[model samples]
Target chain A: EPEVTQTPSHQVTQMGQEVILRCVPISNHLYFYWYRQILGQKVEFLVSFYNNEISEKSEIFDDQFSVERPDGSNFTLKIRSTKLEDSAMYFCATRGQGRETQYFGPGTRLLVL
Target chain B: GESVGLHLPTLSVQEGDNSIINCAYSNSASDYFIWYKQESGKGPQFIIDIRSNMDKRQGQRVTVLLNKTVKHLSLQIAATQPGDSAVYFCAENIGTGGSYIPTFGRGTSLIVHP
Candidate 1:
């Protein structure tokens, strides 16, 4: 089965530095999303993207966060200034039309120290 | 609906036994729901889903039961195996104007012993 794929399985970055997490959603899916799971915590929604614009975002998705579909296949989340609290596992998900099932990618572990 | 802190509710079962995980959702307007399994060092994998109109839906070795009256959801696994050991989450799909975003609850950990 086709699955969502993400790059840089793990990343370590200094606080205050910029970080970009990349994902390639399933080719035919139209809706994409970003979610984060803090260690030992529930996964939280960050933002949802469709048609190259943000559909909805959580309060955690503040000024520092942004998402883009720079190409047909790539969806990325960029944090302008990483904070220690920003360290978490970031996951990318995609949903095709006509279905409620959203497939998730093996997450990118972001460690902002 | 959200799980905070370090302790996660855990269930332990013997291999080949059946396992059931339950969740109480907060959204009365949520019309769709999903179950996801996340192993250590991985993201949530879609297991099964059900709409508000359905009471139960079954997949290979798995079943999802929805009790809309009480806002409850449960995932049942038949013949559980070691590979089924993971954190299972229940999510509610809330949509408006044709857009849907899922909200996740703190997951319950399942441990299957050999």
Candidate 2:
């Protein structure tokens, strides 16, 4: 089965640094999403992308966060001026058109020191 | 704010036994629900899903039952094996009109002992 893939399984950065997480969604998928899971907390939605524009975003997705399709297959999330609280597991997910099921990737563990 | 939540934080079952995990949603507008399994250090994996229009759906050795009247959903794993041990989460789609944003529950930990 085809699955979403993410690069840099683990990312480490110092405070005030910029980090970009990359994802390659399923070839035929049309909708993409990004979520984060803080240790011992529930997974929270960050943003959703469709048609090269942001469709929806939660309050947690603030000015420091941005997402881009960059290419036909690559989706990226950039966080500028990371804070210590930014440490968490960032997950990339995608779903095909007409499907509500969003399949998730293994996740990129971001550690902001 | 509306959210999806699990009834229990953990459940333990003997190997070959059946396991059931429950979730509750406070959003009445949610029309789609999904169950996902997450092992330690891994992302959530899709298990099964049931739409609001359906009361029950089965897949492989798993069954999902939805009670829209009470906004309750449950996942039943038959003949649970040790490999089935993981944290199970139930997510509800709170968006409409072609936008689907899933609110994930806190997750229930299922431990299967062989």
Show model 1 residue runs off by greater than 4 Å: B1-8
Clashes of each: 0, 0
Worst 10 residues of 2 chain B by lDDT: B93-102
Q: Please identify model 2 stretches exceeding 4 Å from their true place.
A: none
TM-score of chain B of 1: 0.91
Q: Using Cα atoms with residue i matched to residue i, what is each candidate's TM-score against the true structure?
A: 0.95, 0.98
lDDT of 2 by residue, A58-98 (tens): 99999999999886779999998999999999999998999
DockQ of 1: 0.82
